[model samples]
Each structure stands twice: as C-alpha cells, then as structure tokens.
Target: MADLAMPEIALLGTSADPPTLGHQALLEGLLQHFGQVATWASDNPMKRHGAALDQRCELLKTLVESIADPRLQLAQDLSSPFAIATLERAKQRWPDRRLCFVVGSDLARQIPSWKDAQRLLEQCVLVIVSREGWPLEQADLQILRRIGASPRMLPMSVPGTASSQVRRRQTTEQLPKCLLPLVLKHNLYGFNTTNP
Candidate 1:
C-alpha cells in the first residue's frame, strides 16, 4: 500500500509515436493537479506503432522539454507495456511518494483486464484523465472499483488531437513544433521534409 501522507506523483506512459499538442496539454494539466508528473513513451503491446521506441522517446522528451517545468519529467526508465511492471519500478525509484497511475478515459474500460490488475490497483491510485471524444462512463468506473481500484477523475480536458489522425492523414498540424524537425529528419509516420 502507498503512504497517503506522502506526496503523489503521477505516472503517465503512452505510445508517443509522435507526441502531439494534446499530450503536451495533458502533461501541463497533470502538473497543475499533482506535485510531480513522470511521463514516458512505451509500446502499448496491444497496438502497432509507426515509429521505434527510441524515436517515440525522443519525441516525448522534446515535448517534456518544451513544457519547461521542473516538476514534469520524462522518465523513460519507467517505460513498460505492463502497467504493473511500471508501477513496481516507480515504487523502487520513489519509495517515499505515493504513485498515481495516470490513464486516459479511453483506456479505463480495459483496466480490469490488464495483467495483475488487482495488484496494480492495490499499489497505486488510478487517475483517469478525460479525453475529448472518449467519455468516461459510470459503468466503467464501477467496474474498476469492483476490481479493487480507487479511481479519481482529473478535472481537465485533453485536446482531441490524436496521433492516429496525424499518421493516417500524414499531417503535421496536430504535432508540436519542436517535434516537426525530428519527424521530418527521421521521416516518421510517413511524414517527410516536404511537410511544413
């Protein structure tokens, strides 16, 4: 069990194929709600990624750097496809602080089915950030609680800019300006130097 008296650190892991403005907004919002926020880019294991893990990490690092907040850290060491494994690693790194695993509302329904879901819930508080299109349902929250999770809703709205749209349309409008040069240099997500 985490120490409630300790400061809470938000752990956010995502498949940042090409980090978008939405990701930046989410990170900023998390910083407002928590004392510290640790974010990383990792393979989701369930979905296919356009860029390699290292490339995604670079993009995420750029996004974190752009935020220019000391409280927001790009902790790639905690990157893991399994949330339980990430939480365990985080516990080792910050044993004195309470860990709050951050996930978007789109992923809320899949929590109960995750590996070692019960144990993961027991170790950290689950903080769900509401995405623009994906609404958080009461039934999903109930299911998470039934499976031993104490979930809290983050009172912030995430921009609707999704990486999928960027990849499918091969557009750079959704991407952060800092990532544009990297994306063009690497030719990631089928985007080339021709794109502005």
Candidate 2:
C-alpha cells in the first residue's frame, strides 16, 4: 500500500521584535489546525527598525525553549519583503511538503494590495488569524474568494499584546516571562542597561 502524504507546514511570518505570550498562544492554537508550525521574523515594510533580525530570532529561540514544543521550528532563512518570495523559498527548502501561510486579519485585509498579490495567494494556503479589534469585513472576505485565493480565518485568543505596546512599556514584567531576560539582555526597545 502507498504511504500517506506528509503533513503541511504552517509558515507563520511576523516581526516578533519581542515574542509575547499572545504570540506563543497563537502558535499553540495553530498546532490544533496545522500539522506543524515554522515561525520566523520576516521583514514587514511597516516596522523597519526595532531590535535587529538576529535579536528577534534570539528572542524567539528563547520562547521556543520555554514552550519545549518540538513542532514549533524557527525559520529565519528568508527575509524578503514579498509574501510570495517567502512562500517560494519555503517550497525550495521543504520541496515535498505543502505550505500554509498564516497572518493576522489586519494583514489579510492589506494582502489584496501587496506586490504580486494574486501570485502570493496562489503560492500557499492563507490562514488569517482573527484577533480582537482587527476584524475582517464581508467585502474583504468576498475579494479573497473572487480572486481565487486559498484562505481560512481562525480566531486567535491573544492577550492584547502588541510590539508597540511592549516598546512603550519597556518593562520585562510587562512582557512574557520567557522573553523578559532576552529583552533586558539585549536592551531592546529602548531598555536602559544601566537602569534595568
């Protein structure tokens, strides 16, 4: 008898300058839907400057260690500005497996305006995680359907965590327990080394 096909990989792209508990929660939730998750900090045009890519990767590594889940893999191999570019690269790395691109509802709304938007949609299955405040509209849903896009909306249970808010607070106690030391060690988001 023929063996079953390999499980698809969920490529979750983000600018996790400081990986939060909410982000961790989202990953845990994703495991229920997707086979496995490959998370990485890709370049989002909106937030250009913060803690550098290496720093972000290091923080993610720390969180992964704390979670101790083998399914969650950190993939910072591609730093492209276009979603399609990243999707293609993942294909190259894991040629035989399928790929699922996960994004927030806010990002989903903006995808229609991205570079090679239609091509991006075609590259992989799009999983839009619906968070509080940034809800998807009916028209946005209709556009996705009209464009021949492969998409699914998953409700994410996050604790109102935003990198912007973490930056403003500049307090490790305000962030995830696993992430606190990394932020302090790197002096991220304007954390004062001498003071902290």
Model 1 agreement with the true structure over 72-181: per-residue lDDT tens digits: 99999998999999998999999999999999999999989899999999999999999999999999999999989889898998988899999999988899999998
Candidate number with greatest lDDT: 1
For all candidates in order, the CA lDDT equals 0.92, 0.76
- Runs with alpha carbons beyond 4 Å of true place in candidate 2: 1-6, 193-196
Q: Pairs clashing in candidate 2? A: none
* TM-score for candidate 2, residues paired by index: 0.89
Residue 191 displacement in candidate 1 (angstroms): 1.3
TM-score, each model?
0.98, 0.89
Q: Candidate 1 lDDT (Cα, whole model)?
A: 0.92
